[model samples]
Target: MATHLITGASSGIGAAVTRRLHTRGDTLWLLARNAGRARELAAEYPGAHTLVGDLADPGRLSWAFGHQSPPQELDSLLHIAGVVELGPIGDLTPKIWNEQLAANLVGPAELTRLLLPQLRLARGHVVFVNSGAGLNAHAQWGAYAASKHGLKALADSLRWEEKPNGLRVTTVYPGRTATPMQEKVHRQEGKEYDPALWIDPESVAQTILLTLDLPRDAEIQDVTVRPGS
Candidate 1:
């Protein structure tokens, strides 16, 4: 089992992945913005470790990782922490736009950069939990769309740089997951979104496990999981 470091470990897909890793008996390091929730999960699982930090402050990423009690000797990094800020392109405030970019795009990039030496030591993998919106586009998802697009591009470049170091990169494009983020979108869309169309969080975690378990010589370059009809 891989020793993994994941962000956004408190709930939704991050929490689901945490459970999957727990059941597999893997050591996990988790990042949560909220201390209460993080500690709650830490209490639930024996070896689950939590690091509290805000991804919105890109500069603090290195410091956050640096200050961990036990330095993360992570075999893989599942960059699962991300935020979706929505507003019409015309009215998208600069503050929200920057925060979204920092959290969803910059923070992940910086964390991977800071942790990559450790990952290289283990010949590990970096998994980007990208969104379907990252690959395509939406009408009013200005900040969210831009951040994910940046994420997709970053993953592509990292795949090339890190592949030679025995690092495997997998970008999973989850389509309209039934997480709190999706709830926000659904609320915004009102009658437009069908509840039947949202993908389950557990399914995303399962696919992540499957990707990680693939043979050393091979790689599943990408996986797109949509809700079942």
Candidate 2:
């Protein structure tokens, strides 16, 4: 079974992916922000492992992982954890921008850097769960979109730089899924959240699984999942 280290495994798309992978008997390492969260994920996934590192504090992640034992080799590193805040450019504060950037971009980069050796050993794949905002920035999506755009750049660069090592990188840009984060976005927009109107997290999970299951002869560099009409 392939081993995967997943961030944002507690809820939303991350939870869906975790459940699917666990059910398929894959080895999973779930990243949590703290010991309590790690315990919670460990209890939920049973045999799955847990790592504690706060994505909001990217600077401290190296120290945190140094204290814990991560896997020797990783078949895949799934980056799905992210934070979002919505406001007009004028109303957004430095703290808000920094918080989103840290959680969405910098944290994932640092985590990937820390795990590169393990990934290279396994000839692994890295999947970044980006957003539609990454490609197009709307009025209120400045900081979050900027972070996601940076994520796209990170994945693109990693794809080329790691090609010689047989590492594959992909960025999945999912549009307006029915997640807690989406609900928060709706609240910020003062709109109603109807689950039926958005893409299911399981659907995106399936897409991710497909990418993992594809033949080694080829790679899916980027894919976008949009809500069906």
Per-residue lDDT value at 188 in model 2:
95
What's the TM-score of every candidate structure? Answer: 0.94, 0.99
lDDT tens digits, residue span 35-117, model 1? 78778878977788877777889898677756666334778899888887667889888898999999999999988888888
Off by over 4 Å in 1: 70-72, 192-196
lDDT score of residue 94 within candidate 1: 88
Scored by lDDT, the top model is 2
Question: What tens-digit string does per-residue lDDT give for candidate 2 at 149-223?
Answer: 999999999999999999999999999899999999999999989988999999999999999989899999999
Q: Candidate 2 lDDT (Cα, whole model)?
A: 0.96
Residue 70 shift from truth in candidate 2, angstroms: 0.7
